[model samples]
Target: MFATVAFAQANDDLTINTPPSIVQCKTTMISWDGGVSPFDLVRISISLSMHNTETPNLLLSINLRAKCSVTEEGVVVEDFPNILPGSSFDFFVDFPAGATLGFTVTDNNGDKAETAPVTVQESDESTCLSD
Candidate 1:
């Protein structure tokens, strides 16, 4: 959903404490537990799961052109979804205006990343972009 929900426990029998690792632009929180790599649960599960934009998307849903800075490179996503590849601390799943959305972020070894679900809907106007 738009928020946390319980997932099945891992073979380790430890209920994954601390919800999924969500990386919202400035509000980033990434954690790993239950012997399950964050990438496995978040990236593999959600990324592969999404069908299309019209489909009710998983988390990291709203920002058409938002920037969540996990590093100097940060995560600069545009309406056109021009995602630059690089090794970063973590990654965020973004749904741009048109076309399909995908989580294409890799880690330091240039491998894929695991992330939490995030829903971003701002009622207020943005100062980041200008007309």
Candidate 2:
């Protein structure tokens, strides 16, 4: 029973999802969360797979953006350039407090694939004077 519980805990922490793609499919934006700083580091992850008959070449890429308000528009914060096939990358961007954060990933062919958005809020335990 102990072994089973441990296995379950591990499995719960794991993320299982299909890859993101341009020609074949849209990329999957994993998660976006704020950290403990005035300029918090927001992490973004993406997976890509190009397996369509039209584009046989497997290519992947990821990028991130941010906004002041969740209801307002967002601007590109960080560009990850390119991510090759069978590989994944994670990046962080400094987001101001109370700002809305957004992310988007594109394929090697320069196509907008996936997007993830999150609103930044003051952490309960944050010690910073400014939110």
Candidate 3:
């Protein structure tokens, strides 16, 4: 008798990095390594969510989309125009202090990455919890 096996391929070229912790209502930076060639337009899809840290139940979720340009060095993000590959892209969440925050990133070709829940710290006096 003969048996058949299956294998899945991975895109090892792409890499992602997110903050382990972030202050509530403040901008946080998330970056990723780039391997796509220059002059390509990449669709960026992002999702931000909050959950109760103690309970581990989801509380809120927000979805956002953007377009980025690929250059010889890396993808140029509109929010951070001068950034390079593995530099960073910024995001802000209005979650309350002590809430667990998480995010995901995906490109046009279905390449994606996600992070484990991170703790949200109390914001400074100048920061507002929501818009």
Candidate 4:
């Protein structure tokens, strides 16, 4: 299995450091200001606008994962703008290392079918967009 791993600078904006697998979009990576954050959980939300399509309720999924995501540490919280199905992007959060980055989808405008958040690495080389 092939995977891509990237590191973000301290108090840096990771959106500019887009990897080869990640497509540049409006996906905002809200990182740390210095040390810790005032909030506990770093929430990730998506804003998708689907137009005339065969399946209006077609579910498109994405797995946002990082090495340093923590509830108390205030890892990373990002907002995806105008995201569509099958489009690849990345979310950068201020995490340490070897920590579990669990993302809970909040205010899901796309009506994602996943009841739970998924942590996926860049491993899929195929797309099921034709269905």
Candidate 5:
């Protein structure tokens, strides 16, 4: 008897490399790798929940509004660019006080990868001063 092996190819192999940590009313740097389609648009979704707010179920697991386009000669063009393999993008997100945030990145091919859910802790620092 003989055995054979097969290797499968991935249409989209996007991966999120951001570590899982508690976000405490601060900006968190999110990064990823192994995505394709420079011409494809990148969509980022963040699930947020309020912890210190009086309002209930506010801003919970909502898709963040953002814009993406291609670049030409170091200038961003109003078109989708083809993202090469092994390329990466960085997203900076600010977590307001009393909010918990988790996020994921979707490639142009409709494939997505996410970081482990990170809970946002209430910070002692005030985002604004009360009058």
Candidate 6:
């Protein structure tokens, strides 16, 4: 059927704006929301290098542990899961509270398509700690 073909075509198309390139913390938050159909599986990955070399060293690897949730307060939440295209997800990491974070995204074909960096900030510190 023509309609079925069209649907498939549309669903195959996926697009998203990469997150920041440098984040500043151990717990970095990443989010993406674009695709023709709900993403079957979405993941946030990282490639670390010490001096920004052509090939950074492999420091660590991980996948989202649950589904991402968007809160009314504009905060994106994620437990980690296989995301569907045309949908969105969010997750946080456990980097230092003030360390820079970098990451990339890959599609179904194991292709690193996009990269984003963000600066991490301290969640909140008690005034007493300042002393």
Tens digits of per-residue lDDT for model 1, 37-127? 3322222222212234333333232233454322211132323222233122234433222222223332223344333333432323334
Candidate 4 residue lDDT tens string, 31-129: 222111122223432221224332212223332442222222322344344433212334542221112233322122222211122222332232422
In candidate 3, how many clashes are counted? 0
Ranking by lDDT: 3, 5, 6, 2, 1, 4
Q: Write the per-residue lDDT of candidate 5 for residues 31-96, one digit (tens) a residue.
A: 666554442333222333334444333332223234433222212112223545434543333455
lDDT against true structure, model 4: 0.27
On residues 1-131, what C-alpha lDDT tens digit does candidate 6 reach at each position? 99998767655534445554423323333544333432333333233333334222233333345443322221222223345543445544444333334433445544333334443444453232111
Worst 10 residues of 6 by lDDT: 70-79
Please name the candidate that would achieve the greatest TM-score relative to the true structure.
3
Candidates 2 and 4 compared: the better one by lDDT is 2
**How do the predictions measure up, each by TM-score?**
0.25, 0.33, 0.51, 0.23, 0.46, 0.41
- Residue 34 lDDT in candidate 1: 39
Model 4: residues >4 Å from true position, as ranges? 1-76, 104-109, 113-131
Q: lDDT by residue for model 3 over 52-130, one digit each (tens)?
A: 3343432333223433232221122222232333335676645667655454455434555555557667767435644
Candidate 5 least-lDDT 10 residues: 71-80
Could you give candidate 2's per-residue lDDT for residues 5-38 as a string of tens digits?
7656433322212223211111233432221111
Which residue pairs show backbone clashes in model 2? 20-27, 20-47, 20-48
* Candidate models: Cα lDDT each: 0.30, 0.32, 0.46, 0.27, 0.44, 0.39
lDDT of 4 at 97: 19
Number of clashes recorded per candidate: 5, 3, 0, 1, 6, 36
lDDT for 34 (candidate 2): 20
> If both were scored by TM-score, which would come out higher, candidate 2 or candidate 6?
6
Error of 2 at 114 (Å): 3.3
Instruction: Give the runs in model 5 whose Cα sits over 4 Å from its true position.
Output: 1-12, 39-93, 128-131
Per-residue lDDT value at 116 in model 4 = 28
In model 1, which regions exceed 4 Å deviation?
1-14, 17-24, 36-39, 44-89, 93-118, 121-131
